[model samples]
Target: MEDWKKLYENPPETGVLFYNETVMDHFRRPRNVGEIPDADGVALVGDPRCGDHIKLYIKVKDDRITELRYKVFGCAAAIATTSILSELAIGRRIEEALEITDDEVIKAAGGIPSGKAHCSLLGVVGLHYAISDYLRKKGEATSGDKR
Candidate 1:
């Protein structure tokens, strides 16, 4: 845990990531923070270096992502990113959902620290993994790969 006071103290040298209200709110009360019962697809990803883990679940209908849910075990950045990723992906075509970018998520979250920017990949990669799982189960090809 970071020292709250140290975080607030204006560091004349090194910069700090003062989490915006939006990020804090999302982290505190993340959206779609659970599993989908009988999920059509699921993925679990972890950044071994950061010890951050995310488990993503989804339900697809007619080639669209009708539902998305997730559980994150990591920093506030991880939680916030995944929370907003769910909002961005739900009700979109699987292809479109996979297109959700780190920039878009960061914008939706009102910007995260540049240092933690990589955390955004967790959500995007999670979606990719879960969607790929769905495609494989459906006996479909993903990214032009025959399987």
Candidate 2:
């Protein structure tokens, strides 16, 4: 537990200093911090021992993401990544949002502290699974991979 804390909290100063103000703001107060009552798609992803979790809600229209929201419970980077990721997904087509990777989130945030890279993984994978769920529910073919 302590090791995880160190990993999340004791990132090198030189690394975190580069994060953009927007990232920091979102990290401190993540947007869309609640569940969608009747979400068209909802996904929960995390490592239990790592104490990271993210839940995504998506509404697709014409195969595009017309609405997206999320709830995140994790470290700073995870929350920041989740906030930015939801914003990124909202106006994008479903397939396009699925293409969003951890690298892009990190880059868009002006780069996350190196050791915190896994923090973004939760949001990335959560979105992937959520979209997959949506597609599967809609009778679209999928690999049926469950992470």
Candidate 3:
């Protein structure tokens, strides 16, 4: 509760005009909400208790992620986190995309509400899992595989 309270007291910048606008705009108009029919890989995760579910799709070429998309179902925080993550992953090298962390996503969203901080982790986990799926399909064990 303390962390959530702190967020309420000092909301972070969400790259929007209004502080809350960041979360609202993202949730309302989430990016990459559909599927890519030819996606190389896909990852899905869900928190049944919170009813937070996210699916990420990625397309890779020459060890770089050329495309990324997502379909997320959850609270405002989770949806916004997914939106930001998809945008960041596109056109990134696979390794670079894998390096993206929950902290980075949260910070980019002007800091999610303290109560919703965990939602950011959901997005990170989804991304990692999605990348793992892509790597596995490409016959690699982990993102660290140099070959």
Best by TM-score: 1
Q: Which 10 consecutive positions of candidate 2 have the poorest summed lDDT? A: 138-147
Scored by lDDT, model 2 comes in at 0.82
| lDDT digits (tens) for residues 1-147 of candidate 3 | 999888777756653323367777888898878888888888899887788998888889888888888888788889898898888888889889889998899777876667677788888888889888887877754445776
TM-score of candidate 3 versus the correct structure, residues matched by position? 0.79
- lDDT order, best first, reads 1, 2, 3
Going through the candidates in the order shown, the clash numbers are 0, 0, 1
| Per-residue lDDT of 123 in model 2 | 90
- How high is the lDDT of residue 4 in model 3? 85
- Evaluated with lDDT, which candidate comes out highest? 1
On lDDT, who's better, 1 or 3? 1
Report the candidate with higher TM-score, 1 versus 3.
Answer: 1
Q: Write the per-residue lDDT of candidate 1 for residues 32-123, one digit (tens) a residue.
A: 89999899899999999899999999999999998899999999999999999999999999889978998899999988888888888899
Each prediction's TM-score versus the true structure: 0.84, 0.79, 0.79
For each of the candidates, the C-alpha root-mean-square deviation to the true structure, in angstroms, is 4.3, 6.5, 6.5
Put down candidate 2 lDDT per residue, 3-100, tens digits, no spaces: 87886677656666446687899888777677777777889898776798888888888888877788877888899988888877887888799899
How much RMSD separates candidate 1 from the native structure? 4.3
